[model samples]
Target: MAVTKPFDTILIANRGEIACRVIRSARALGFFTVTVYSEADAGAPHTLQADRAICIGPAEAKQSYLSIEAILNAARATGAQSRGLAVHPGYGFLSENEAFAQACADAGLVFIGPPASAIAAMGNKAAAKRRMIEAKVPCVPGYQGPSTDSGQSDAVLLHEAEKIGLPVMVKAAAGGGGRGMRLVRQHAELLPAIQSARSEAENAFGSPELILEKAVVDGRHVEIQVFADTHGNVIHLSERDCSVQRRHQKVIEEAPSPAVNADLRAKMGAAAVAAARAIGYVGAGTVEFLLDGNGHDFYFLEMNTRLQVEHPVTELITGLDLVALQIRVAAGDRLPLSQDDVQLSGHAIEVRLYAEAPHKGFLPQSGDLVLWRPPTGEGLRVDHGLHESGQVISPFYDPMIAKIIAHGATREEARRRLVVALERCVALGIETNRGFLVDLLRHDDFAAGRATTRFIPQHFETPAAPVADDTLLNIAALLWFERAAAACGHDPAASWSSTGRLGSPVLLQYGETKTKRLVAPSGGNRYRVQDQEIAILRRDGCRLRLQVDGQGRDIVFAFASDTLHLALGVRDFACRDITYQPPAEAEGAAERELRAPMNGKIVAVLAAEGERVSKGQRLVIMEAMKMQHEMVARVDAVVEKLPVKVGDQVATRQLLAALNPAAE
Candidate 1:
């Protein structure tokens, strides 16, 4: 039976892509949209998309998105409550906070998610596992005890680990998403692993509670999307395989896993439904499991009581808008489809576009995005919060900037189309994993549907960055020449025969390597650099059409100061013009400087002034992009200066410590 509309205004109590996603669905359903933002996101896409936007607090999440009081105040100040409002807590910040859900209920506002009781039942891994065991769900064998901060001694955890055997997973009981997780394979590593995981958990999730599970090696990460309503209707919308990962975070996801057959899907789907029902779950949630390689046995991992980052792939395959369904269910409407009514269509694949350098251990990067152009196609969808070029990708949020999804009649077609779409994507000024995603999709293992959770580690463990070849160097030189000519009040596309036969020497640097080349104009729109001849056929903003040594090529490029950021095919290059600059300084003392890898807050400082440290010893630990990074000593040296302390926010390349060589 249809009920009265519960709300007319929907307030998105989150930021970034997810906020934008909810706004689209809420507005489509004729609901007035309200969004909240931090000071950093004053001009963000989500804020701009909403009919009304409010600034909750500063950039820090605790003071903004995670603050229940601030969100409530914003809702009240905007008169959302007077008009009947529902708060849509987009995934991540405060999405699964039971207290926040109860607070909304106490304030006579509808929380567009599972009930507070359900969230509490499933939020803690230890409690959830105990409950699932009682509900007869197959779970990995291990220990579920009190947290370290809650009087659970280390001895008890160690004893449990020994009983469960080696190679166990230490996980945060209060959170998911791979944060506060560690895999311990050796006896000597268990203690450190537990400590590290506990610390990270306390910081990321506000809880130090932990659980142990038998490490399921070489298993496939599969999750089932389940939805329920107040009318006692629950259905699973197929399965998604998120096996390809790094640092325990999913990189690629696809719906209708290749490993699961009809029978297996039914069984897994039933188990997922059971898990949700056991917790009295409502709205959208995901039941994750680790599927064995044999494609038969599966074990429950955890249940995410919120929409997942990879929801688009399921939406594409099932032809459903999960966000819209979430809104409908929150408004006292029964589910539109039953279990038998749900149909999975064509295969769909999605990849996260992160502002990170894959070659450098997937280190998150932050800077002004000089250019942002997502590819458009029939079967492709790009969900992002970036609206225009020159937007700052701040360090206060996750590094994932967008998600690209593709749908096709078959898995191979979907894979192929995703690769092409990724290749066509243009994100410059900041480093990204676009090229890596392309290569991963084309890998023989991935193409054959044999990728397991160990896909990235087994292969591409030390993936190298693409090197700048001689041809690329020549192109950079020519582009630099054209820009220089234009800056001097001359048409770069015109002939440059007036410069004479010797040509001008250009010094270009790619990374730490520099090369000097002689470039001269041969004729109109033609130039000779070294032994290669190039002709510029066309120029459209950053796009260049040229014939290099009789081979026609098209390149996408951008200029930031003296640096030229260009994408030649799938490879990206950032070349700096060092022409007419003195470069005779040698790096001696600079090598002893220990600097922050990215913008983050220092969590630990292990070294002090006047202390001598060995090479490769970890000196500091900082939290950036919701992950911890260690700054290590480069050489055996005496600490000359220790400038930073715990809780200090640091910028990239800022010195954390300075050292001097030890006396021989």
Candidate 2:
């Protein structure tokens, strides 16, 4: 519906990135906007963006963003129009809460999305799957019927090792975004996983009920975006390839899967349409599916009954304002457009830039962001909630920093632009997944469109493997020394640059103690370090950039390691410190070696030297934060030794198992 005007005023009951986006859109539409925030978010972007901003409650989500009473009160206090909310629930808190939707209805206002019934229906995974089945939509095999967190009620779960066979996954009835789920491959591990999953489900969502579905081997996760209006009209916009993921969460998404032909797209699109019509669904929602690699069969996973994070790509393809469409539908306006009215034109891709590290084990990072520079220019759309000096990177909420999306005439162009866009995108003062995203886009399989949900952890390796290149550290050190020497007023051309001025002590800080190094510029764009001369290049900063021949040409830098990484571009390079710590030359003995998998702790050790173990048997349990993960043997072997134990600290490459196939 192309309206010549916007709504009078919009009440927003959400927080963070999506909320800020809604306010921007509403303002552009000539509407007044009211924003609500918690006490902790008094200075947040969304709060600052509103014509009228109100503080709802304290910092804790239960009393603040998630409190229905407080949100409604904020709405009433600031709103004077029809009392409707542009209501961008924004991915978390009250977005999917059905009771909140019903409350919005009882208070005489418009809910900008699906009805309360649809929210309640789609809220429950098992119920949603059953509804899809009734709607004639395809579904995954296994028991997804009326199952709750009854814990051990289904013979299908325990026998899952026998039924769908090994490596079956158990999911919560209300699980979304990867919580309340477990992967069990053995009988001994089933009950504990179920208990832990149930406990988490009950704690996080107040419902321990769960559903079980057969794990699709090498499943390519793809979802279709569909928009429906109150006029009983529905349309499928396009599809997003969300196969690059970790822990069941998507990191990268691309529109129009390279593997999906027009014929396959039609089948998936029809299924998505059937799903929306089944619930009499209205507004915009995404229907997720697990597509087989063979491009033959696909099944309905779940329908996200709200605007998705990756909606920008769909907008790029069809050139529709899904948010505006949602507002129009909520305002009692007819859809105006039918199924044929919607069209998919071009290719688009979205990357979720998070404040985490990829090579550092995708560890969640929290700190003040000294800098925030989003990539811009042609085909780039940035949706973010941070500023040059914002301070909301706490452990309280999701670590998503921004969403960078690019659109182009074709999928190849989109991918190419995506790579370049990330290179220019920058976020400092916190660990970020920018490097990981760049690595993924350049990965062999991803470039050729060989994607599945397992692509990330499978290809990148969790607890990132240590890199074999030592030249990067040497380069970084050289840059550090170069900057220090330059700042101390030393001619870089002199071999005795740091020998001290006229017999005084020359103190320079490297780590803690003041150290001096003999420095000399050897020829053009080159440096002589001790006995070796290395090539140095001019990076984007005042710091001396060095390129060593012994080291590889991969790690890129723009700033120093300090309170803030003052860089101008995205940290889009996979960096791993895989240096070999060999034994002393005289000892003639060595430790088997160890490496961390991701940034985590060693929770338990289940093996010892000469301990015979079968393939796929548990060898070690590494714990990160509050979750525990077990390391299993890839092949039948004897444990030659164990270097780690319970409560031991470890990084991704830390050794926990040593297999001797000959001993086995």
lDDT of 1 by residue, 82-153 (tens): 668999998988999999999999998999999999999988999999999988888989998755444456
How high is the lDDT of residue 497 in model 2? 36
**TM of each candidate vs. truth:** 0.89, 0.76
Single out the weakest 10-residue window by summed lDDT for candidate 1: 582-591
Identify the leading candidate in terms of TM-score: 1
Predicted candidate 1, C-alpha RMSD = 4.2
Cα error, candidate 2, residue 131 (Å): 1.6
CA-lDDT, candidates in order: 0.88, 0.71
In candidate 2, what are the lDDT values of residues 1-664, reduced to their tens digit? 3222224778788878898888877787777888888776788888888898989987667898889999888777765635334455666778888898888778765677788898888888888988999898999876664443343464545655456665667888885878898877676887788778878898877887776677777879989998888777788887888888888888888888877888888899999999998988888899999997677899999999999988888888888887777777776687767766777788888999987766666767554564666778898899888775556464446778999998999877888898998887767556687767878888888888887877876887764532423343334444555555576886544443345322122222321222333334564556654444567665554333445555424333444233113332343222211112132421211122233444456777887878888877888887653446778876677787688888665643456776666562
